[model samples]
Target: MPNAVEPPSASPTRLEEAYALLADASGAPWRPLAGGTDLMVQMTGGIGEPPERVLDIWAVNELRGIGVDADAIVIGALTTYTELRRSPVVAEFVPALVEAAATIGAAQIQNRGTLGGNVVNASPAGDTLPVLLALGAEMVLGSAHGERTVHADDFWPSYRTTARRDDELLVRVRIPLALGRQVRFRKIGTRRAQAISKVVMAIAWHSSADDGPWADVRLALGSVAATTVRARTTEAAIEGKRPTRQTADAAVEALTAELEPIDDVRSTADYRRLVAGRVLHRLIRDEGGW
Candidate 1:
């Protein structure tokens, strides 16, 4: 391995400056550095050659806070897992996200590992992706020209790949908040802490009241498919029904059919498939009693 040496980089304090630099250096082959939680490891020999230059936007104030509007919550791309776990806004609007964030790595990792890095890295086992997908999040991409929004479901079509343009940066994620909508997130890992998930599941539902029939529901899972994906068949099965053992059982069957699992270092395909169903069933029974 090469000696540990600093790579050439530029640190921009403002979002506009970062965008301008990217635009000015267009096609010059640079990588944007956010938290460096994943990139730093890769630099130490996880994969391909390190980038010749890195654009450091970690201190960009524009990409470091959470904001809310009437209909949605906007989480800046650089927001860390620790920040998410600590935010009262996140606690209220998307508590399940907090649950997911708590399961990623340890204290130091949570402090430096960013939600944007997680999204851009596009790991199939990324803990937050399933929750974001279930919450119907929207990704905002920024370039010198302007900003564009893409649905989270449409963002990742394959493993470790996304619709992000080379010249663009992921600025923030918008998570929708509707009345009476609740979400549940669960990560089934080999162990509770510092373990990569064997299977991860998130479910969101909306109804008229706490005990009302389900008006709509969205379900997503990770580590069981090419990319984090929706359990559309399972969602369709229980959309209008109240949570019941019978309904959950049928939904579990639907979910099993929807998943495409494969053996990996962390877990086996059969285990992931079977556990995914049980997790959904438990989530519905425990949180979806309405």
Candidate 2:
């Protein structure tokens, strides 16, 4: 007979209560449970026992809203993908994020999966990660002591690891508004709807006019490196250049050089590299009408 799984020792519904529990050093380390879309899966699938202490923050009102400040759109960590799809602000300023969010899962997963959970899970294949990296988003973490912000580029320093401290909660994400930039997001997976991506990418750029040169190009990719990475070399190569096939090919060369994809069950490193280039080429062609 199989052994029964153990339940979390404590479940706190309020933010303050959760913090106090985390601040207590005498107890076991508490894993903050947001939507449990990812954590629950890990726990059920893993060989070891589930976490002994879980801080359930699903009902914490402080972590569930979307607002706009002077320069950026502030999204509470608990904001669901469904909320993102419905948000006019997200549609207007960060449509790529909306696009990425729509591709996460079916309606049920979209309803329960929070943005914070995705960020904290820190999967290299996470769909929204490339969008966040391209948009230059910032993560806001909070603890009983205080709050500190980390840029998205620096958030994931290694594979499946984030800069978030054990005692800190990912409170929210702030995305700076890039009003007139042309943004694109694409995910190449085995199947369209619910499959993990082979290669996921997001690209954003500014241009003076419809036919002008690309400026301030920002390109980011997931499943191509240890962490979702901004393709700085590729961006630099494409910057100030018109979106032509030659330019796109050159950008791809630079991008291929920068990425270090590995062979996994989902895709081979060569296939990922090839698809990434193809996607970038198509994006450039479509954007330029070439």
Local distance difference test values of all predictions, in order: 0.89, 0.88
Pairing residues by index, what is the TM-score of model 2?
0.95
Query: If scored against the real structure, what TM-score would every candidate get?
Result: 0.95, 0.95
lDDT of 1 by residue, 1-290 (tens): 74377678999998888888888754565689998988888887636667777899899979889989888999999999999999999999899999999999999999999999999999889999999999989999998999999999899989799999877899999998888888888999988889988999888888776656676788888899889999888899989988878788999999888888999898899999999999888877875554
lDDT of 2 at 273: 89
Q: Candidate 1: lDDT of 161?
A: 91
- What would the per-residue lDDT of candidate 2 be over residues 25-51, giving only the tens digit for each residue? 887788888888888877777734467
RMSD of each: 1.8, 1.7
Residue 28 local lDDT, model 2: 75
RMSD of 2: 1.7
